[model samples]
Target: MKAIQIATYNKNIIRALLGLKTVEKSAGSPGDDEVLVKMHAAPCNPSDIAFIQGTYNIVKSLPAVPGFEGAGTVVETGKNTGHLLGKKVSAFVQRDTDGTWAEFFVVHRDDLIVLKDEMDPDQAACFTVNPFTAYGLMEIALLRESKAVVQNAAGGQVAAFVRLMAAENGMEVINIVRKKESVDVLRQAGARHVLYENDEDFEQQLRGLCAELQATTAFDAVGGPLAGTIFNSLVPDAELVIYGGLSGKPVENLDVMGPIFQNKIISGFNLIDWKNELDAEDFEKISGFLQDKFIGGTYKTKIQGSTTLDKIVKGLRGYIANMSAGKILIRP
Candidate 1:
């Protein structure tokens, strides 16, 4: 099997720090609840990037195969595995001992999620992380009965999913982006509140939009002072959910007094922790709903390009160059 193995950590230019090495290994016999998957495709996500950079909260060993989610076909299964052979599925490899960036991968049979056949490989490749994050976070908004929500990185793939899900749930989003052009792009995708982080009216527009829509939930991906701006812009006693640290910096400009004065809450949302607390039934229900939405409408993700195993460096660099161009797929 061939895999892109990261042997060293590089805070900057993480893609260059990783390498694709041809590794020879045996297909271990599956256990009663395990399956062997012939990998078809995997998407390079922001989490993967952070993993290789050695900055993610989870620490991986040296010579790590860093990847989170992907889709493939089940070629073999254990005795306990029932009726799942030869099925194409989306898989999440949560084992700290293993990763999915390879020609073949193994996972628990129960963890294999059969995907919609009509779905594209790129979409299936991204089946778990972004889509679920967007879907699950929206539930938080719904629970708060928030009329409107705000999120950063409006030009990102997950941001698109957030906007689409919000629209379906009767919630408006104040899409925040560093680039001015993203305002138009998000607007075309049905975002009514698009604010530029670099604009002089950034704070003004944010305050006005929060006041107008009564936004009570902020899904922040880009950290740094951007989070602070978002925290301060929301309605009273709102929730600020930090999901990603795209800026690779601390959340700045936070509403320090909100918790004390307005009873506001600031929390973090990690997919792994969220998944752990959920029962199997709830996980499936949430995953299924998000998958249906993804296959149905604006949930479709645009793919920038595809690459094979040998072109791993090119693929990683390309994705790092401009992630918003589209989701990059590794056709292993």
Candidate 2:
């Protein structure tokens, strides 16, 4: 099989670490509840980089395929999966299985999200990670009855959906970005409260806005001190969900001590872990909800560029340099 495999982990240049090789492997046959999919497209995500660099929560062995999600057609299926044989589907690849970056993939039928025939392959290909994470975390915030939510790295791909959630529910968003230009980007997109971290009054503004809205939950992708800063801004008995460590720093070392005895709770939220908790029907329902948002141009994804199989190294490097540019898709 032709696939981009991670040969080893490079701590310094994690994004640019990969190799294109014609590995001798194949999905021989599906079990009674499995299906074989001929992959159409896959997106290059930060999680893929983390997994290949051996920095993700779950580590893959060396010489393994590295994509996490993609969309494709069910080429063949086991006896129980016969009804799904010709359907278009999106799936998440568990670390142990050969990932979705390849030409073909096989996974349990229950993991598949059957896509509507009119759906674009590109949208479905990149569906699992950002869309699911955004919706799942926002749902948590809504469940907690938060009046507003604050997020670090507000210009991120997944954070866009969070912005949409705020707009739809009339919930205020304390969006913090690093660059001045990003404020305009979100502001033009209907975001009323965008701030820059480099501002002299950044922390003071965050503390004020959070207090005004009485925000009880925060969705954090940028870890480190930023997480602690947001933690301190929330009201008492607030909850913080740290889902990504884009800062490449540890949560324990942050200076803020709000979570110590202020009734602030800090926890982690992984999309894959949340997916694992759902039954097949519930997973499909959530997928359908997101699909409706995408198809309606509400929760849309921006594609910076599409890369072929051999150009994955260049793609990863470009994405790492400018994550806010957009998602880079692998159209093999």
TM-score, one value per model: 0.93, 0.93
lDDT by residue (tens digit), candidate 2, 261-310 = 67889889988789888887888788888888888877778888888777
How many clashes in candidate 2?
A: 0
lDDT of 1 by residue, 1-332 (tens): 77767677677764434444545566556678888888888888888777777787777777667677788888888888757788888888767645788877878865568877777666888877788878778879999999999999888888888888888888888888887777787788667888889998889889999989999999989889989888888778899999999999998887678877877888888877877789999988887776777667647877899887778778878887877678888887
lDDT scores in order? 0.80, 0.82
TM match of model 2 to true structure: 0.93
RMSD of each: 1.9, 2.1
